[model samples]
Target: MQFDFSARQLITRLIFWLSVSSFVGYLIGHVWAAMTLVSVSLLIWHYLHLNKLVTWLWNSKSLSPPMAEGGWGRIYDGLYHLIRKHRNKQKALNERIRRFRDGAEALPDAALVLSNDLTILWGNKKAQNLIGIQWPGDVGQRIDNLIRFPEFAKYLEAGNFESPCNVPSPLDAEKQLELRMMAYGSDQVLFLARDISKVHRLEEMRRDFVANVSHELKTPLTVVRGYVEMIQLAENDFSPQWLKAFSTIEGQVSRMDRLVEQLLVLSKVEVNSDVENSDIVNMPEMLGQLIEDSQWLNVDKKHEITFDIAPDIAMLGSDTELKSACSNLLSNAIGYTPENGKIHVSWQYDGERAKFSVTDNGPGIKAVDVARLTERFYRVDKSRSRDTGGSGLGLAIVKHVVSHHHGELVIKSDWGKGSEFSIYFPNEVISSLKN
Candidate 1:
């Protein structure tokens, strides 16, 4: 394509110029008839060659370009080079696509390629078996129509791929699958599915074990506390040392009982993830009750407690779970804050979102420890947590409840200042429950 056409053009142009000059010379010498005949013949020959070159370029159907002679050969050579380069580029592109398809096919997870409209464009072998869509027969069929499920369809329509959705397997009865989708190109989607039945089953087993153990331990713990109290009542018969031992026994027993109760609540929350959302919680009523409980707990410390509740900000969620989560935050704040500190409980809607937050004038948590505060048995000051009778599972239970309600638990604090903890519910869940 880069070959210089100027040489060919220059020579042809020079010949034409020479003919015109010769014709003028002859005309001046009074040989006008001879010059006219020579000019006409040259003009006719040039037009014929030009027409032939145009026809070859526009209509020729050959593997190679037309075999041209003279100046036309250069033009033909440039066209041939361009055509070969284009063919090479096409071949390379096709090879890369083939390789990509091969790699995708080798993946263990099922994969689906969909068009802009969610039509089945292509699918791998795993998809054929798991998704139950035949390759050629199902091609161009709507994916939503083929694999219909309310949750899966809503996930597709939502256009938010930040999370994956779990759905029952279309193939096996005892199997479950996690489906994740990603968008590429111009509106095309790629969906992948992985079997998660084993993982799900293991989690269920663990929750069941914890719930059973917690439930069983409650009775013995109550009996132990009862006997310890009975011995304290007969303190006059024993020494002061015996009375002190009874007090320690009673406190440790109560602490252990609280831990067991928290564990049971956490297990129940985890197991009841699929519970129906039929409980409508009255916000002010719940908060007022929590405030009363906090007041009694703070009697010794005499901390300032305040409430900024939106009376009408009620929600449809598990009342038991919500109360537990909210109470844990309040109790944590009360326990951690020093005497004369302030604790504020607020519930309000900020334009598009609603939140219930607890602000405490306590020693702020460390930056590195804040992230893991929600983990079970995690404490910044283990001795202080023990003194406060905290089982260290309160935040863990709060985290589980928040996630179960499709909400987020946010923690914000600065060193030596106070900390604010909030539960921000998902807009979709709130809107749906309101309707």
Candidate 2:
């Protein structure tokens, strides 16, 4: 057993008592010696009491808590409390992690957390449904082992994270998917996948429709042009009545020509609108050309036309396309307006946008028909449109051109108050004024 008191303390107490006993023995005669012995014994007893108190204070295990109710019962109590708090904190952290996992798993798109070595660490329910994964069984499986596409495997190995890549679905042979990879945390990656089969199908259908229409129109147009040339060459051989018949044929031929032209313009706009070679069209010059073209058309009906142009209001787009769009709008305005009716072509430039409006005093479009006006071959007054040499595709072409250039085409009309067609081009197409 170890003594709590130091050797120096014990020795100091012993020396003090020895000096007291010797002084007492010298002061009294024979009785002094007996009193000195008793005093020495009492000093020894007091020293023992002090030693016991020091030992009790220093030796922690020997003493209990003052109340045993409030203070810690033992040193182990601190350790037990620390352990319990740690367990509670760990349980809370685990619950939070579980909540996060549950939320991630419920997402619609397939999600997979993968390691740098391409092993899948975790996957959501959607991922299992899409990629045929079986819970914990598929956890440690390599991505290549699960997804057996050379293109996807190559993409993963390349490690280029600039943009997402598309891959064929392993679950369905006919379906396609878009796969995107993101660096999530240290040594971990996330793969997100979405189904794009419907989008691909729609795109394919659009291309086919355009191609079919172009081919069908091209054949008819070629035949009509050929017959017109034959009729022109054989004019002398035909009667006066044949000449009138030729005039009718010529009108129809002209309509066909206009149809072909519009079709070509629409096709070109669709293909090249998003490309860089498209030029910045000067709106004033284009509108000037449109005005001149409208006057030529107006000569047949003797309609009154006016222009309210803002100087140097330019837009970035194909010159041909804008001219075609403007000409179509102007022609429609002129066609619907009665003789001597006023038609206004106005242009204005706000700080952020440029707008062109073609207003006419004519039998305006009804509200119910305005929504369908931009559809191909949709005409409010088909007989009037056909008689006025309209191809029923002018508004469709205008809508397509406006949409391609990221512009807005709005039509405001009342039953009899006339119609106003406004086109707004964003500032991205028309930046700053040039002096």
Candidate 3:
């Protein structure tokens, strides 16, 4: 322990020195010579201690202070305390890092840290087992080089993490992985790979069940609808109440037939990958035909429909699916919009992306309903939907088609005002007539 070097103590030391010099001078018969001798001896003692402190500070690793007396001793002790405090803080920090790494290693999902350049910085053991990222050996390797799937590479380069990509594991043919990338800490990426094989199998089973049942129901539904129509044609053979009942049956059977057909289409689109079959779609011509069909469907409502189609605005996708999606949009607008309501459609490419948008002055959807419009069998107003003859699968089919073509369905609506639905296709899929 070191005590404070107070001014009073310093004054006492000076007085002692003066008295001793005066006594020595009286004996030596030279006062100046005695004082100079005392001063030089004190300077030499301080210099030796200062040298020791400097040497210890510059070269020694020990946290203990150097042995000294007076002011130098206090300084050494202060430095030792500072060094010890810093060491404790550093040790605690190191321990926390160890705990975090241990916890990450115990995770079920494969986790990896990647630099902005997508180089592997660190990975958990699960990453090694699942994606074959070797410990220490694969560090500093480009992640794209390791997971060489073209889709994965594209997804990484796109810088979009709102959705994850599902791909098969490289090591096992049957295993499925859902990979997601997240941005964290100073331009680093947290890449996660989850084993979604069970989930994928279940989804496949659901799709297969829907597809098989829809196929089986299609024939029976057709037969029922035909018999109902035949009974409706012979209206005089039945009483007025029976005829009304038969008409209701006919309408319901028709709606059921539409629902079954949509289910089949939806299942088909879901089963096929985004790029399963590729072709250049003549979007302008397709929209023109759909507009004509919408006009026929709009005869009763008399909605004022118009379109501005860019001449050569084509895209690379499945033509049948695209047409179906476009038809759904137009049909919905005609069915829902009030009489004489304005519906405008446009197709344009702004170099970066191609867009198809439909704007309508319909009974606009509420904010809460807009988000779930694409879900199968979702209805904002069930009574209104039923009156309009909607099967509640149109928007769902549209969403799947857009997603299958690597596009997005963007819906914007203002309650009691109007709504706009747009599909945006990235430039990679944007094509043109090769004239």
Better of 1 and 2 by lDDT: 1
TM-score each candidate. Answer: 0.81, 0.55, 0.84
Error of 1 at 149 (Å): 2.2
| Candidate 1 global CA lDDT score | 0.84
Better of 1 and 3 by TM-score: 3
Of the two candidates 1 and 2, the one with more favorable TM-score, higher being better, is: 1
Global Cα lDDT for candidate 2: 0.77
Clashing residue pairs for model 3: none
Best by TM-score: 3
Question: How big is the RMSD of model 1?
Answer: 4.7
Model 2 RMSD in Å is 13.7
Instruction: Give the per-residue lDDT digits (tens) of candidate 3, residues 100-192.
Output: 889989889999999999899898999988888876789999988989897898897787888998878888869999999988797999999
Ranking by lDDT: 3, 1, 2
Please provide, for model 2 over 94-136, each residue's C-alpha lDDT reduced to its tens digit, 9 standing for 90 to 100.
Answer: 9998997899887778898899887899888888777777567
Task: Give the runs in model 3 whose Cα sits over 4 Å from its true position.
Answer: 1-66, 134-137, 233-236, 276-278, 350-352
Kindly report which residue stretches of model 2 are placed more than 4 angstroms away from their true locations once superposed. 1-209, 212-223, 229-236, 273-278
Residue 145, model 3: Cα distance from true site in angstroms:
2.4
